[model samples]
Target: MKKTAYITGGSKGIGLGIAEALLKDGVNVAITARTQNDLNEAEKHLKTIGDAEVLVIKSDVRNLADEENAIQQVVDKWGQLDYCIANAGVGKFSSIDEMSEEDWNAVIDINVTGVFNTVKSAIPALKKSKGYIFTIASLAGTNYFEKGAAYNASKFAIVGFSQAIMLDLRSYDIKVTTIMPGSVATYFNGHTPTAADAWKIQPEDIGQMVVDLVHMNPRTLPSKVEVRPAVPPSARK
Candidate 1:
């Protein structure tokens, strides 16, 4: 039976790349995001990559109801869900004193609470399938830096949360892994990828990692993974 996967924020960047990889493996995939236009574009592009079925859902991870409904849609369409990637997140950078309440809340709400909702809503389905869960975190989760107060706090929370849940869900035969990546060449933070960004990790790299993990021996679980560029730009200079 072909496994089914669901990805949040799968309209672009890492999410889209993951979807393409899974699709190539013949996994039926459902991808969700808040924007209909982005989803439409993603759907079109994804279809060209693989023959696997693709389901695009318009969902906002911050809303529990929306997440619940999105999962339900996946289960309803695919009949089973073998994997879920809670890749929906946001980053807001600013010093504590300079950060607006709105920006702080948005960061926490989307990055932390969003994953909670996505995972919580998918638990019942995953339990039945003994599936896998992947959360997209960042190196900043552990390393603190200036102007990263809000973003760091959220990613840090995700790393801890994903680890705790890995323990909680293991008995159910479900695997949870958190991927902390450094400097991916994506449209994240409103930064367009240019030639200068070639040195950064590409989204497809992360996608390939997920595929490898899914194919790993069931007895061995890599619960936490940290990825960085092989050679940073500074090393060349």
Candidate 2:
């Protein structure tokens, strides 16, 4: 029997890439996004990849009830969840003085709280299967930048939260990993991904890493991975 993976925000970008990688490896996958249209599109695209069972769930991780429902749906279909990638995140870049409370809350709700909800909802099933949990953070989580107050805060909180959970769940044989990537060429923050941005990380790179991590021996847990461009634009210039 193939292992199962549940990925949040799996409709596009990094989440989708990871889902594709898992499917290619014969892992059953359940992906969630906020829009049904995106979910349908992802389902269609994923079907072309491999024979693994695919489930597309319309979900907003910011809502606890929705998170619970998404997890339940995956469990009902697959019977058990062997891995979860909390890849759903949002960003609003603005200086602290200009950042609205709404903007800050929105970032925090989806990045930090959303992850919490995903992990909490899946803990029981994960515990049973000794599953892995991967959280997609950012370099901004550790390196502060101008006009990145909201995004930085959320990512930083995610790093701290995931570390604590790693310790908390280790006894249960559940492995938690925090993946922090630098800039990637994705349609994030209103910018469309393009070939010009190829120098940056690709969603599939992160996805592949997740697959490798999942297959690693149980005794070796690589709990933190920081990925960045081998040579950044400034270096090229």
Candidate 3:
């Protein structure tokens, strides 16, 4: 039987990319996102990948019940889940003074709490399969920047949360990894990816990285990985 994976926020960008990669490798994938339209579109694209079965679920990761339902949906369809990616996240970049309460809460609720839900809900199945977990974080988790108070706080929380869980979950022979990417060329932060963003890390790069981790030796665990473009704008000058 082909391995099955569950990915949150898998309708687009890095999440979708990872699902596509895993699908191509003969891994059945179940993707969850808030919007049905995005999920439908993603499912269509994912079908072009390979023979792996694709399941698209409409779910919001911020809700624990929703997360649990999403995971249960995957398990119901596939019988077992071999991977869980807590990749649902949002960003609201603003200085402390300018950021609104709603923006702050939205970021924290989705980026931090959402991940907690995703991982927590998937733990039972993951333990059963001794699967892998990937938390898609950002460089802001470690490197703070101006006008990034909300986004920074959320990412930082996720990084710490993911690492702590890595230690907690490792005893079950389940691997956990947090991937912090610098300036990936995606729809993240409402930016339209174009040729101009080519220099930045591509979503597929991160996707392939996850695939590689899945294939790595069980004894070797790269718990935290920070990836950036080889030639950033600063370096190009």
Candidate 4:
């Protein structure tokens, strides 16, 4: 039987890229996002890529019920799910004094709590299938900087949470990995990806990394991965 995967925030950027890669590998995929139009667009593009089936679901990861329904939908359409990616997140950059409570809540709620909701809802299926879980964290999770209070705190929590779950889930034969990346060339943080952004990591690059992880030997698990651009703008001559 073909394996199945679920990806949150799958309409574009890293999530879409991961969907494409998995489809190409003959994995049936169900992608979810908050926007119906974006899901529709991503569904159209995904259909063109691989022979495996594509299902687009409109959902918000912050809502546990929504994630539960989305996972049920995937199981209804496909018998088994082999992977679940908690990739829906947002970044709010500001210092402690300048950051508003609303902004802080949004970041923590979506980035941290959203991930918790996704994995919590998917745990049953993942345990049954001995599936894999990928939490898309960031280098900022470990390395903090100026003007990064909210984003940094959220990511740091994600890294810690993902690691703890890895230990908790491993006993059930489920694999959990946290991918921390830096300077990805995507629409993240409202920045447009143009030619000038070519030097940064591309979404597909992260997708390819996921593929590699999937194919890795079952005995060896890379619990956490840190990836970044080889030559950042600061390093360019």
How many residue pairs clash in each candidate at the backbone level? 0, 0, 0, 0
Whole-structure CA lDDT of model 4: 0.94
Best-matching candidate per lDDT: 1
For model 2, residues 1-237, the per-residue Cα lDDT tens digits are 789999999999999999999999999999999989999998999999988989998889988899899899988987999998999999998888998999999999999999999999999999999889999999988999999988999999999999999999999999999999998888888889887898999999998999888888899988888999999889986
How would you encode candidate 1's per-residue C-alpha lDDT over 46-127 as one tens digit per residue? Answer: 9888788999999999999999999999999988899999999888888889999999999999999999999999999999
- Which ranges in model 2 have alpha carbons more than 4 Å from their true place? none
Residue-level lDDT of model 3, residues 9-121, one tens digit each, is 99999998899899989999999999999999998899999999999999998899999998999999989989999898888888888889999999999999899999999
- Candidates in order: C-alpha RMSD to true structure: 0.7, 0.8, 0.7, 0.7
Q: What lDDT does the true structure give each of the candidates? A: 0.95, 0.92, 0.92, 0.94
Report lDDT (Cα) of residue 207, candidate 3.
88
Which lDDT tens digits does candidate 4 get at residues 11-89?
9999999999999999999999998999999999999997999999999888999999999999889877899999998
lDDT-better candidate, 1 vs 3:
1
Model 4 spans > 4 angstroms off: none
> Model 1 — TM-score against the truth?
0.99
- What's each prediction's TM-score? 0.99, 0.98, 0.98, 0.99
